[model samples]
Each structure stands twice: as C-alpha cells, then as structure tokens.
Target: MNIQLRFFASVREKLGMSEQKAVLPPDIKTVGDVRLWLISRGDVWAEVLAPGRALRMACNQQMCEPDTLISEGAEIAFFPPVTGG
Candidate 1:
C-alpha cells in the first residue's frame, strides 16, 4: 500500500525531510510495521526509530497508536512526544 509519511520536530531534522510518500511492502499493515520497516534500513533509521523510543504517531491528521491500520493515501505522522507545563 502507498501511504504518506510526515515527520515533525527533531524527527524531521534527523531524517532531513518533512514528508514523503512510501510504497510499503505487503507485510507492513500498520504504523508499527512501518516503523520497523524503516529501522530495517539500518543506521540513522534504526537510531531514530529504535525500540522503546517515546515517539508519537498520527493517522490521517488524528493522533493514533502504532497498531493503527493504514491504507493507501493515508497520512501518517511521527514525532517526539509533546509535553505541556
């Protein structure tokens, strides 16, 4: 499936892009799957998306969890968790 990915804050700086379109493999069905897939690319990918990272996700502009199922044209966002005082 083809999905749109948006990276924000530090994540965006690390990846060097704000957004991208990805054609995911059939085995990747959810946001978590996408994260793992990217990590598989090694180096920066593995570090940015490392296991247990406190990252936040959004699907189609709405906040979502990693288990959220994504479809063609769906927009997925990743960033560090936000905090408020």
Candidate 2:
C-alpha cells in the first residue's frame, strides 16, 4: 500500500525529511510492520526506529497503536514521546 509518512522533531532532522510518500510491501500490514521495515533501511532509520526506543505514532493525525491497520494513502507519523511539565 502507498502511505504518507511524516517525521517530527529530532526524527525529521535525522531523516532529513518531514514528509514523504512510501510504498509499503505486502508484508507490512500494520503500523508496527512499517516501523520495522523502515528500520531495516539501516543507518539513521535503524537508530531512530530501533526496538525499545521511546517513539510515538499517529495514523491520519490521530494517535494510533502499533497494531493499527494502515490503509492506502493513510498518513502515518513518527516522533519522540511528548512530555509536559
């Protein structure tokens, strides 16, 4: 499926892009799969998306879990967890 990807904060700086269009393989059926797939790209992707990293994700602008199913052209975002004082 084709999806829109958005990066935020440090992730954007590292990836050198705030947004892009991606075509995911059939094996990437959910948000988590996409994460792993991106990480497999190596280098910055591996570091920023490695397992155990404290990352946040959203689908179509609404926060979503890793298990969430993604649809064609859906917007998916990745960012560091938010904190407030």
> Which regions of candidate 1 are displaced past 4 Å?
none
Candidate 2 backbone overlaps, count: 0
User: Mind giving the per-residue lDDT tens digits that candidate 2 earns over 1-85?
Assistant: 9999999999999899999899999888889998999999999999998989999999999999999999989999999998899
Q: Model-by-model lDDT, in order? A: 0.90, 0.94
Candidate 1: clashing pairs of residues: none
* Cα misplacement distance, residue 7 of candidate 1 (Å): 0.3
Please tell me which predicted candidate would have the highest TM-score against the true structure: 2
Worst lDDT window (10 residues) for model 1? 44-53
Q: Supply candidate 1's per-residue lDDT for 45.
A: 82
Residue range 41-76, candidate 1, lDDT tens digits? 998889888978889989999998889998888998
